[model samples]
Target chain A: MIRAALFATAALALPTHAAAQETPNMPAATSPSPGVWIPRMQARAYLLENDQTLLEQDLRIEHGLARDLSMWAELPLYEGFLDAPRPSDGEFGLGALEAGIELRVLQHDLDAIDTVRGAVFAGAALPTATDGFGRQSLDPFVGAAITAIFGRHGVNAAARYTFVTGDTDLPLFIGDDGEDVIGADLGYAFRLAPAAYGEERVAAWYLTLELNGAFTAEGDREVLFAPGLLVEAPTYAVELGVQLPIAQEGSDRPEIDLGIFAGLRLLY
Target chain B: MRHPILIGACLCAAHLLAPSCTSTASTPTAVTMSYSAEPLAAGEHELEVHGMSCPKCVSNVDLQLKRLPGVDAAVVDMKRGVVTITLSGNARPSARDLATAVSDAGFTLRAIDRGAQGGTP
Candidate 1:
């Protein structure tokens, strides 16, 4: 399923849309504080087998509707090779449009420097891609995320499942079988700069590590290990990371050899 | 695939149906009405804010407080969860106003203590 891989590559950009004070490659239970609006952009390149490469640029926006409610929308543009075997030069077009809402279910402020939060989110992707680059059907998904922060160390985890409603005709290992998809991710962040907080408004630096896994209904599975660095200020953030395949099994498409991403975020 | 979706849906439904479970325990009650009618004197005021754990969180509080008219400066001590605000001369922001700003920033104002006029706490 070259189409599946294309969509999956776009989906990988979703985690970079995290709210304020979150790692770059994982879903965090935290949202923008109430009345805040965040705009984000990310560029990603995936190096696949057969000398093929997929490039994606994603633009997203997030808004805090209330103390416990937040929403986000994302649109991606893709340009690169789709057929691993054929290895044509490439095509460029828009990908699916995705939107989701998150509701914080549990939040506990243990103290001034420690807190824990949990949230559940649901959303759907509209088949808005240019011809031959998308699933061409509405796909619904659901997920849960958690965040725990203890001083300079933070942990975030999330899991999601998407219902694939499109049709795939390519043979197994080269194309998707139209089966649903499941994904799970875990991330850790350590503040590397500004050993302590003070009165001045100083930019903070963070080192992050994430483990991302995806599985298809037909047993195709892939896991990636990503490490990143982030610099965050009061109203903006910059981040960059690299992803390497740690394990892959029962895949039905071209394997990803490497992925690199860079992103920026601004809050208003 | 279907199983995971079903479980996630059920969990979402369970959480949505239970408002109490989703509410934060430290959500501040309506205490603004208890604030004195008199505006805080022109001076530095120390406020103990809750639910701030990161630099961005601190910045949120800082920005909201500085948005209030008459606030000369807002200094934060993150480790102590304290924000010291200095009011300019002729500035007459009420306690309720300060509390509302903090609330709007998604934090709780646990307590406020006024310092000497025109001086740091």
Candidate 2:
């Protein structure tokens, strides 16, 4: 089955570079190039399956400290069936707490409508969750990301590795073998509205497609294709997307049939 | 299995329905004046900044410039990529300071004019 903690961690792993510049399922390496200090808040919900329904709500906050540095944290609350047809009432509680920092290593503004950037990030997941929801250990992770923007088209890619510290006897999802986890994602976003840039502030709409993959040291692999829509203003954004598993190989847990997510982000 | 075609159709529908939500105008013309590294005088100053394509970009430049000492206000003409800064009395912020502020906001300061009147110098 889908482990609530693992799902939550994967969903909230990366920090956004700008107010609404990131894709829904992946991180953007671009820094907050247009703001000195921008703080952002996002509330996201996900619905997925193992053999039963899994619903999770994630709250995230990010702050840009400088032109090339940013930090973020996330907390998740989950409600779902922990097992197949067991615990008929279902279970509800908090998941792991994760925090991270990203530093832009390279940024080149090619012109008014084109740019490239790269960043590296590191953080840890703290074991602060209700029973049957957390790893009960501190997990450290590191990753790098890159972004490129040309006119109305943008690309983002990131890869991360997380080192699981402890093991549990509970019917865990992935990483129960104390093996590390690896994840990678690539996303493309195309501006669908305001086909061109102008003087006045306008709400921007984007169509995004992404490929997200996860692998474990114990030969578990899963790859999902996610397509999403985003409506972004200067101060806030609304996003909705759905994920479909295209590949599931050697997975020790239940296969994920489908996943849906929606989120709202506010910038200050 | 999930219906990929259905999801794609929904996304397309959403985009098509929102065609009139935002303007589709092209980029505005920008001032192309050159600036010298001379000392800035107290009063109003205009700066030509580069790589500002959105309102948020203008806001960032405005906020950073206003944070500088003696800067009373900063107004951005996004179409022209020019920022007009009002300086308080006795404010002697140099051209380098203005450039630095723009750089800190993730853009480049291309030119600066000391007075409100436009001239080629």
Candidate 3:
């Protein structure tokens, strides 16, 4: 009886290799992974009403703090034709500093070929204008974003609400009332090159179209359409885009007709 | 400074064709593609994972697996989507516990293979 008991104990102690079981498809995970920082710089040129123009640049950095949490910050510089017909003598100064944190709430791997990701974020824009560039008030905002990926094609939709807090009586183009902004980005990635299994790197090219719309509590509204291209690798990506205003309301305010943007992001 | 449109156009055209024009040396190398395993411990396990598409995903699994209580080391192979985990001496976690860790890292564990002595290569 003691020998039989010892045999049973040995049998149970043997290694157990679990067989492969079919798992239900889960949601898609983010590409950059967690614990990485991506820093990007964007420059824009805007064609405003009355043949005036605005040139703006932004340096943005984002970090994935955890699997479902991330943070970001941005510094903006602005140059605009404050005086008519003197494009060379326009006001050039710093605009605003913005920061935010995001928490991913849902991610679903629909199948082998599809994924969905969603997140919500809260942000603040601090008044850091040098002279004639930005609003002189603190603005806090909340936003949500969702991305659906189908193999190489993807779509991103985001909406943000800003609560304006200071100097609401400024010019319409600079400061209005609290506003709502909505945007959508659609992209398709082409594997221009493939990396071997043991190779250290890979590359992909993408074409994207973005539609941005904004509405202010004071009845101001506008829409912009942008088309862009992107080339991304493991640690770096470059993007260029052109924005054209497709719709607008409130004629007395300065309006942007066309704009261009180019940016690069570096990961570490 | 003078003609923003011309500069922008030139920059865009150059960037669009740069990837195809340049070789791999110019592209950023993949990060965290390989893992160096530590010396084997007593309670080691190997998992066959699925749905890892890039090196970044490998890193994600690595981070999560290392967070487990008894996990001493975790190595992930992006190409094979395999994960090998080592637990400290006298520390043993069930196969289901490991499967849950992989799942929490947004991956699927297809199979769990344990060694005779609870250590897997």
Report the number of the highest-DockQ candidate: 1
List model 2 lDDT by residue over A80-179, tens digit each.
6646442323577777798988776665555655667677777887887666665677877777888777778888899987777765554234664566
Residue A119 accuracy (lDDT) in model 3: 62
lDDT string for model 1 (A21-42, tens) is 4767667887765677777677
- Give the least accurate 10-residue stretch of model 1 chain B, judged by summed lDDT: B21-30
Residue pairs with backbone overlap in model 3: A26-A109, A27-A108, A27-A109, A28-A108, A28-A109, A200-B30
- Pairs in steric clash, model 2: none
lDDT leaderboard ranking: 1, 2, 3
Off-target runs (Cα >4 Å) in candidate 2 are A1-20, A31-47, A65-67, A84-90, A170-173, B1-39, B42-46, B50-55, B69-88, B113-121
Candidate with best TM-score? 1
Predicted model with the maximum lDDT: 1
TM-score rank order: 1, 2, 3
- lDDT (Cα, tens digit) per residue for candidate 3, span A106-192: 555444324566666667789885555646677776666666655556566667666666544334352344343333333333323
Give the candidate order by descending DockQ. 1, 2, 3
lDDT per model, in order? 0.73, 0.65, 0.54
Candidate 3 DockQ vs. native: 0.05
What is the DockQ score, from 0 to 1, of model 2?
A: 0.12
True contacts kept of each: 0.48, 0.21, 0.03
